[model samples]
Target: MAKGKHNPERKAVRHGTEKGSVTLGGRRVAVEKIRVRSVDGVEIPLETYQALQDPELLTRAALERMIHGLSTRNYAYGLEPVGDDVESFGTSNSTVSRRFIAVRQLKST
Candidate 1:
């Protein structure tokens, strides 16, 4: 939401980058965000593009696994291996549980 909110009354003048990280297919990857700039140079990210970068991706993946009978304790085992070069974290049982609860709370609100 921080990067991509747009004002339709304005005209898009150019494209710019907003670097960030996002998880795709269970692997966290770096991304260069594409944004539309107004004549005054105010960057407005594309809604669809920003949605692809939502951090809830990991939470949703964890929830899907839970719905399919994978316990939170086994969450890490469910992710696609990112190899030795990538430092792995955030897949612990407690972390997954917390993420699931957070998402539920957000949905309720």
Candidate 2:
């Protein structure tokens, strides 16, 4: 161990999980949750990093599905299976409609 590193007196112990989804090999895969600690005892959650969430991919998937004539209500049905553990959120008709509208607005602007 490095000198004074992870020392409770010198540094605080941090605990957190690195859990999120990211595109790997063109597939969105959920990262196995990992416990991580900081020298200063800060619980740093890697999932909190917005970059790892891959919103763009989700948006693109939604847009593509919509463009292919898939109804917003049936959006989730068309998604590639992402395992039962991965809760499918943001694929609801309202959310999809909002995202689609946002993209359309962007294109028109």
Candidate 3:
């Protein structure tokens, strides 16, 4: 990730302008409003921000990333061996292999 240079003198002001939504891998995902200070001290609202600051959101994001990563790798490898093979591509060992399998099956069909 590229870090934006920060300017301390600028303060940000944020407002929830519109409901946030995005299309990831053909799936429509709704996002929450986020307010952050830009380099110029102007407030820019982010439709998708940190899921970490909120425990529940973070958990959901972690699970999603795991599933996405697994499914992506599985497809990349042509979904050969199952089970423990899936673990080699994720950020953690606790990923749900079955969920990734389901995603793989969905993609193949």
* Model 3 CA deviation exceeding 4 Å by range: 1-8, 16-18, 35-109
Clashing pairs in 3: none
* TM-scores of the models, in the order given: 0.57, 0.58, 0.23
Best by TM-score: 2
State the C-alpha lDDT per candidate: 0.74, 0.66, 0.43
Error of 3 at 59 (Å): 29
RMSD of each: 8.3, 5.7, 13.1
Which 10-residue span in candidate 1 carries the lowest summed lDDT?
A: 24-33
Q: Candidate 3 lDDT (Cα, whole model)?
A: 0.43
Task: Give the per-residue lDDT digits (tens) of candidate 2, residues 1-109.
Answer: 6876654564334455655656432235666565556675566555654465666776787777777889888876787776777644666688878888888899999
Q: Rank the models by TM-score, top first.
A: 2, 1, 3
Model 2 residue pairs with clashes:
12-41, 13-41, 14-41
The deviation in Å at residue 3 for candidate 2 is 19
lDDT of 1 by residue, 59-91 (tens): 788888889999988887788766656654567
